[model samples]
Target: MNEAIMEKVSADPFAKLLGIQIIEIEEGKAIVSLNIKENMLNFHGAVNGGVIFSLADVAFAIASNSYGQTAVGIHVTINYMKAGMFKDTLTATAEEVSKNPKLGLYRMTIRNQDGELLATADGMVYRKKEQFA
Candidate 1:
């Protein structure tokens, strides 16, 4: 992945707030992790759903743009399967599900340190016209 793109993403407020890291970026996938902190919890002390969603969203952003050809997210359907508690690291891995000349479908999972799934998402990305594939 491009260093400039990584810089632009890491500068986002929510990413900085949650302390998310872009662990790996490859041709068609991206993995991001967040080390949960005390401030990330809600009134009940459970990690907020928005935080999990953000992690997945960022993963999608990086994955969609990983090819060095810009793309935009058309939609994403996210599901919260479990609550993340305690201070722990959460990882999200997004992979391309399908692709055509113009559209790509991707899915990602947010997992706890133990590899237990906390959330899942399916995203649609629209690739722009460019000489690069």
Candidate 2:
């Protein structure tokens, strides 16, 4: 099940476009990483907030849908604590906070290669009855 979910998430076009990779994934948990590229930086020379948010969102999506149920993010809030620089690797890990039949809550932390916290996010998803199969 985990393998299938990983494969499914790996095939995400947006993730592929941003070079996001799934480092690890299991039921209710996922870790993803991305290397900060020049194109990913903002005018201030730091990684764009949207890029960081997308990395976190990918982790959340993988964790929330690990159970094979189709889940879509309904709401999310993120806080940026530090900036990511070029050539730095950013990793985001997501863990389920709570889940029911209809909804799931998740928390995500984004860190740099040095383990410095860069951002955090809380997300809610609406789980559909349909399966990923």
For model 1, residues 1-133, the per-residue Cα lDDT tens digits are 6676666666668777667888998877999999888887888988898888889988998888777677789999999998998687999999988877689899999999999999999999998985233
Per-prediction TM-score: 0.86, 0.97
Best by lDDT: 2
Ten-residue stretch with the least lDDT total in model 1:
1-10
Candidate 1 clashing pairs, residues 3+ apart or interchain: none
Pairs with backbone N, CA or C atoms under 3 Å apart (clashes), candidate 2? none
Tens digits of per-residue lDDT for model 2, 1-133: 5667767888999999999988998899999999999999999999999999999999999999999899999999999999999999999999999999999999999999999999999999999999975
State the lDDT at 65 in candidate 1: 78
Q: lDDT values of the candidates?
A: 0.85, 0.95
Backbone clash total, candidate 1: 0
Judge candidate 2 against the unseen true structure and give its global Cα lDDT, from 0 to 1. 0.95
- Name model 1 segments beyond 4 Å from true: 1-13, 130-133
